[model samples]
Target: MATPPALVFSDLDGTLLDHHSYGHAPAAPALAALRARGIPLILASSKTAAEIAVLHAELGLGTAPAIVENGAGLWQPGEGSSQDASDYRRIRAALQALPAALRRPFTGFGDLGEKGIAIATGLPPEAARAAARRQHSEPGLWTGDDAGLLAFAAALAPQGITARRGGRFLTLSLGGTKAQMMAQVARRYGAPLTVALGDAPNDAEMIEAADLGVIVRNDHGTPLPPLDGEASGRVLRTALPGPAGWNAAILDFLKQLDRRGGARTDG
Candidate 1:
């Protein structure tokens, strides 16, 4: 059998899941349909590993891999609750092995509990300021206290680090983009097709990289700026916004696929 795309990397907040501050529900039938299809719905978000775990458990996706801290860390599922001990040790060792000048700062709830970690950098003044603005406006929405948060973002900036916003918090990374992470996952799973959906600036990378990029609308039914107007053919900007918008976009892609004999792949 030809390998179907094993992964659908989704931005949690404002894309697959709504931002209700907390206690948000995935759009029922849409989420159910994806789950039913046996497609691995990967939660790619700016959320900390712990925060993502809450959603993962709620969604009943046990042991799925997550691209956390804006791609600074790839948290693979292990035999038990947390990352495999050997894998965890490998990541730690790899991180420590880097020169002090090259290493980026990071933290997580797993550092606190089974939740996970949130890492940050202390470079790039503009990015650090941008992230600080977002995190300050919404406290407790992320895993850090004020000091940790600033220090977290700051740690990444100097090493050419930056943060990408999604759902509720800004994700700090040494220099990773959502598109790069999505591609990595696709290569790992041998996914022939990747249908990605997201809203907000942080999602631009994946939106640009996917075989089909679906831009979800906001609550007022306004499509965001085209990811790249010069390359308008690459994106399907929707008239609908929010969860309802995503529902429409995905359904449309499936319909288009069916009409074309499903030859659409390899963006």
Candidate 2:
């Protein structure tokens, strides 16, 4: 692939979409600008491939891929529904193998079913079904105490499974992060100047890894702490929240690139 001027990686919830409404209408302008410049926009989210594919097509991202399952997997464009549930099965099997005391507290999506997921996430029945279609990670509510949680993770570690707490759920994965997947995707695009936008602790690594990082305002979640890049102005925080903030940050950065004569035109 020829080197593009830039590539953008963005978190969906609380970043590119309204935290409550889950709409990106406010970001239409910036989305258009990116399209006009032929810049690839990769949606990075904990959403499953089934879930992300709908939005990927809705956003008209063409062949750009997405970082899905909280970076546990990638969703390439044009791919049909994934038949490979091997990783998901492995993770579930690992959980079942744990002691009942360690296992009973974690109520995973497999245990929740579609109706339970819909109630848990406020997604509609169909959307919850999509969310439940896990391929590489399992997210669940951890009812165990902190010590038990620690023990749970420790036991799984030997099996190559890792646990991360994000929002209301404890997510288990075989081990991959948004930053790692971001680098892999950037390399596919010829490593163009990268910009990453996100609004949570899970996004910190990817934000720090990019050429420019944007911390989109998120009133619904805990604010990200000041990052090292902020001191050098390589990272910026948006004044507004959600997609509106995403729009302003992206447009401003594009302007800066334009002024520096660095914004590459589409060939």
Backbone clashes in each candidate structure, one number apiece? Answer: 21, 0
TM-score of each: 0.62, 0.91
- For candidate 1, the TM-score is 0.62
Q: How many backbone clashes are present in model 1?
A: 21
Pick the TM-score winner.
Answer: 2
Tens-digit per-residue lDDT, 1-267, candidate 1: 244534567776667665443233435655665555556677776654555655677877755677765655455655223432443343334435545544433332223222211223321444333223221012122444556546555654554546455544444445356778888878877877887777776777787788777777655212246677328565776665556666676666666655765433332
> Which candidate number would show the highest lDDT if scored against the true structure?
2
lDDT of 1 at 64: 62
Worst 10 residues of 2 by lDDT: 162-171
| Candidates' RMSD to native | 9.9, 2.1
lDDT of 1 at 59: 79
